[model samples]
Target: MTIRSSWSRAELGAFGEQVAVDHLQAAGFQIVCRNWRCRYGELDIVATDPASRTVVFVEVKTRSGDGFGGVAEAVTRDKLRRLRRLASLWLAGQDRGWAGVRIDVIGVRVGNSPAPELTHVVGVG
Candidate 1:
């Protein structure tokens, strides 16, 4: 396995998103979309939790190291606000009824280890 420390910032981010997707799928989430974007911003992943019949909007944050802060700290209040707006835009474009909507954040920490550390925060906003 390739460690996160070897990748560039952009590559680390993309790798983290893929890891997040895999984690969600393993947790029984059906992926609806990936990298959905608009004028507002971008959503990393859109998934449905079959058990609760809810639409989940996911934001992915990745860091090769924690020099600045931990991966979770990267998600600021402004980010959450933007995510909420983006979620509204997504809902507006949807025709089906959703039981509910939620915002989640996946934080990935990449280092010299073979596998990166992943932290999932649910219903963050």
Candidate 2:
């Protein structure tokens, strides 16, 4: 059976982020913040991987359809550069030190099914 969603675009994006958070937690990431923003841009999800002791800045791209392209396709070189800058800003604001920093991208494809398709591209930046 298929599950239909009546959520608006923003709602869909929020839902996707929630799904991403859940997936990340299950994979052993401790979520630090969500929707962290600055004058530059926004970081969709900030997480810490205990095993790697690394701070991960995540960019989430959520789409209800694939007419344009895969959700990951939306992350361009410019976007990656922006993410890097945002990550630096985030670190500068922190009081303590991080083991390391990495950038990741989460692509969420929401469809008629209740379970959205998710792809995690680690260390994209």
Which lDDT tens digits does candidate 1 get at residues 51-104?
999999999888777776865687799989999999999999999978989999
Error of 1 at 24 (Å): 0.1
- Candidate that would win on TM-score: 1
The parts of candidate 1 lying over 4 Å away from their true place are: none
Per-candidate total of colliding backbone pairs: 0, 0
Q: Per-residue alpha-carbon lDDT of model 2 for 1-125, expressed as tens digits?
A: 23256768788888889889989999999999999988899999999999988999988888888876885688889999999999999999999787889998888888846678898998898
Candidate 1, after superposition: displacement of residue 28 in Å? 0.3
For each of the candidates, the C-alpha root-mean-square deviation to the true structure, in angstroms, is: 1.4, 2.1
Error of 2 at 14 (Å): 0.3
Cα lDDT, all candidates = 0.88, 0.87
What's model 2's overall lDDT?
A: 0.87
